[model samples]
Target: MTDAPRTLADAREWARVGTELVLGAVADIGDGEFDADSMLPGWTRKHLAAHVAANADALCNLVHWAATGEETPMYASAEERAAGIAKGPAMSAQELRAWLCASAVKLARGLDGLTAEQWRNKVVTAQGRTVPATELPWMRSREVCVHAADFGTGVSFSDLPAGFLTALVDEIAAKRGLTELPDGPLPEVAAWLAGRPHALADAPELGPWL
Candidate 1:
């Protein structure tokens, strides 16, 4: 089953937790760290940061579309969006952090003061998938929380908000195709991801990316 966000408030809370996690990691980002490769193959820490911010902006667009009946275009164009993401792998640390902050601010403002009905409105994403406004907050949360762990800043899943860790375990289990809870108490999620497993049960309770 799809582990969609259950409510607008829950989504917003997730967003708040995600933002804190990202900013905490950013606070420790050093000049050389941005260029360092992350767990995602071929992507540096900078690229991951950029991707997280861009996703925040994208989610903001969906929020605006739902709230105001306005089409807040996320990408300049399909080609530009794709190319920009591709170029993220080469960004300087300063550039990446700046972009991330800027994008997040835009999204934060965009989401401000939205009503519950607005948050429940549905919209078609750039990929043509239809989703609720609640999904935007969840998307932002996922990007920041997971990619923050990718930075290798020594933070871990346990460092995340307790609610986030609890919810994320459910998400990971679903993603890994596990339908039943393990026989024993679920293991403490790993602090960081290591490798992919063929079966969900074989994988650690916590998948990497924090």
Candidate 2:
């Protein structure tokens, strides 16, 4: 198995890969490839992009807060942030893409000057949980990767870095509360995350929700 990304540089690189994949998919946005609704309920391509942009901006703010030793709020307000996501309905496709570009620039600037020590600093998430700064890059990677696919651009978890896949396998396995591997052959964990059926015939139906 590939070694998981255990360092900030590794995580950042993974996040960069996600960024490249997403941006590349959006390169020819006028081709109508993004017309379908995303996996997120009621979200079209525009809303998906906007949510990605907003998340980047939010992460940038958290990084800035960590760097300055001040309590940096990830969201302007709970309502505004929720509205920023929930209100993506108001955005046009072109404007959403622009916002994503702007958000990427802002986040890049925020990450550029951090010292190695700062990379390990902890930040409070908008959801009120504390997570290490080292995890932020991975979180960003997850958003960019999954949301890109959610937009129906054809990217999938298999397209993500191998190390990311390994970590995700660990995560998904844990979330399912599976402690021991099945007695049968293991499935391709990455493909499963991208909504592919895995080990379906081996047992009772897990149904659609799982």
Candidate 3:
């Protein structure tokens, strides 16, 4: 079995790689396409971009929680999260892109401020699970990598790193109680399990995946 990222440094490196992929995809798109539909149902590319930007800020809240040993929830409420998602599409493409880039950088800066002890401090995830701050990088990485493809650009599961794909499959399977998956590339299998479109044939239908 592939080992999960065991240190803040390792996780940060992976997050960096994932961010690059996301930015590449975002940068390649035309402004007109921002209004176009994405792979995710009911979400336009602008919505996807907005969610991605907001997610970075949300994760930064966890970083603050870790560094200060105080309670900081990812979002104020479900309504706030929904509102944030709705707000992104209305911005000009340049504004949306700038928000995406700036939010990611802000999160990275927040993470870099954490000391070793701070990295060990517990924070509550949006799902309400309490985990160490070290997990935040992986969480951010998942959002960037998966949603980059959801943008419905040329990006696909095959574009992600093999190690990331392996860890992703394990995480999704454990969370969803999936014991078996259809035979296919690991990336495709992971994508399908995450409720994203994949080329895998006859993959079992799954319930909603976070």
Candidate 4:
């Protein structure tokens, strides 16, 4: 099995890299391009950008939950989550970029304040799975990397780390009950499994992925 990120530090660094990549890709986009449809069906680059920022804030809530031993839900409700995504396109490109960057910084700061013991505290994800606070970085890393690709800008699966691609493929395969995937480069296979376009002709059809 491919080894996952072992330490909180490693996960944090990976998350940092992922965030930088996403920001870099969106840095030059204009308002119209940001509002255009992204690779994700029905979501504009604006929606994707908004979701990324909101996800950071939501994960920050998890960090708060871990540090304070308080129950802080990722979002108030599913409707709130949808509403937040819907609200992304309303911002100007500059505002959207600022929001995304600021939220990411805020989340990092929140995480940095956690004590060693707090890192082991349990927090519930938006999906309702209980996990250690240390898991937040990996969770955030996956979000930024994949959603950056969903932006359909120059960023593609090939731009991601090889290890991340392998781990992502394993995670997607397990989640989707997909045992046999088309043979190809790790990035292409991972992208295909995640419902992204890839060069492989015989890639299996997949439903929505997280």
Among the numbered candidates, top lDDT falls to: 4
Q: Which stretches of candidate 3 lie over 4 Å from their true place?
A: 1-7
Span of ten consecutive residues with least summed lDDT in model 4: 1-10
Every candidate's CA RMSD: 4.3, 3.5, 1.6, 1.5
* lDDT tens per residue, model 4, 1-210: 254645677677768888998899789677678888888898899999999999999998898999999999999999999998999878889989999999999999998899999999999998889999989998998999888888877898898887677778878888887777777888889888888888988666777776
Q: Which stretches of candidate 1 lie over 4 Å from their true place?
A: 1-6, 71-79, 181-210
- Residue pairs clashing in model 2 are none
- What CA RMSD would candidate 2 show? 3.5
Q: Which residue pairs overlap in candidate 3's backbone?
A: none
Listed in order, each prediction's TM-score against the native is 0.77, 0.81, 0.94, 0.94
Question: What range of 10 consecutive residues in model 3 has the weakest lDDT sum?
Answer: 1-10
Give the residue spans of candidate 4 off by over 4 A.
Answer: 1-6
lDDT per residue for candidate 3 within 30-81, as digits (tens), equals: 9888899988888898998999999999998898889887788999999999
- Candidates' C-alpha lDDT: 0.67, 0.69, 0.85, 0.87
Quality of model 4 by C-alpha lDDT: 0.87
